[model samples]
Target: MLVLILGGITFSHAQTKSDSLAIRQAALDYIESQHQPDSAQMARCLHPRLVKRTFWKYPRQQREYLRESHADEMVLLAASYNIKGDKFPPNPRKEVILLDVSSNTASVKLYADEWIDYMHLVKLNNEWKIVNVLWQFKDANRHQ
Candidate 1:
């Protein structure tokens, strides 16, 4: 009985780790797909109501919302860089440090470049949706 209990616990932990990995990879893929990547591909990975957060020098919190229709934004992004036929990187190395999930809510810590970033996600129906993100990038060059 004890052995069975231990095995069950281990299985649960493994499943959680797998789920976290999937979410982390999906997030990275979504970000890369924004660089002349397909909208359909983005629609598969990103939440319709994703929110990006940043804090200004005055301590004012700024938020950008990704609504259902992001075609205009995608066009602008492409035009700015003049990347008409650039394909996204095939593989992005995504590292997930932590994931805490409860029912429909999940909190995750992920390593991108400078350090780990935190996000709150919610599972809506059959979809894992990112509801809030807390991250700040110094500059685009810093991301490189």
Candidate 2:
């Protein structure tokens, strides 16, 4: 009985760790797709109903502003921008930290080259997909 209980606990812990890794990978894919402009990979990371909100200060503006974007727009912009020229750094500073995961829902923080994104994800159809993102520029002076 002791051995059986110990084995069950270990299996449960392993499953949780696996889920955490998967959630982290999803967040990484989302950031990488934008940096490299891979539309297919971006689509794989995001859900169709994704809602991304960005907060930034405009040039010479005192107050910050908010902008919203959908998954389709993100993919379209990734394909349109920086395709011909090399805009991103050779080794951009990217980081993904898993904040929390509960059953089918998870949250992660991604520090991309220029901004920090707090992402919300959901497990759907046996896959993890980013559903929402709240982002801001790393430097308060820089604006989009």
In order of appearance, the predictions have TM-scores of 0.53, 0.80
For residues 1-144, what per-residue lDDT tens digits would candidate 2 score against the true structure? 998888776222123777888888888878777677788888888999999998766666667788899999988877756686476788877788888777788889999877889999998987999999998888866664
Q: Where does the lowest 10-residue lDDT sum fall in candidate 2? A: 7-16
**lDDT over C-alpha atoms for residue 117 of model 2:** 94
Q: What TM-score would you give candidate 1 relative to the actual structure?
A: 0.53
Assess candidate 2 and give its TM-score to the true structure. Answer: 0.80
lDDT of each: 0.54, 0.82
Q: Name the best candidate (by lDDT).
A: 2
**Residue lDDT tens for model 1, 61-87:** 333343232434433343443256434
Q: Candidate 2 clashing pairs?
A: none
After best superposition, candidate 2 residue 133: deviation in angstroms? 0.4
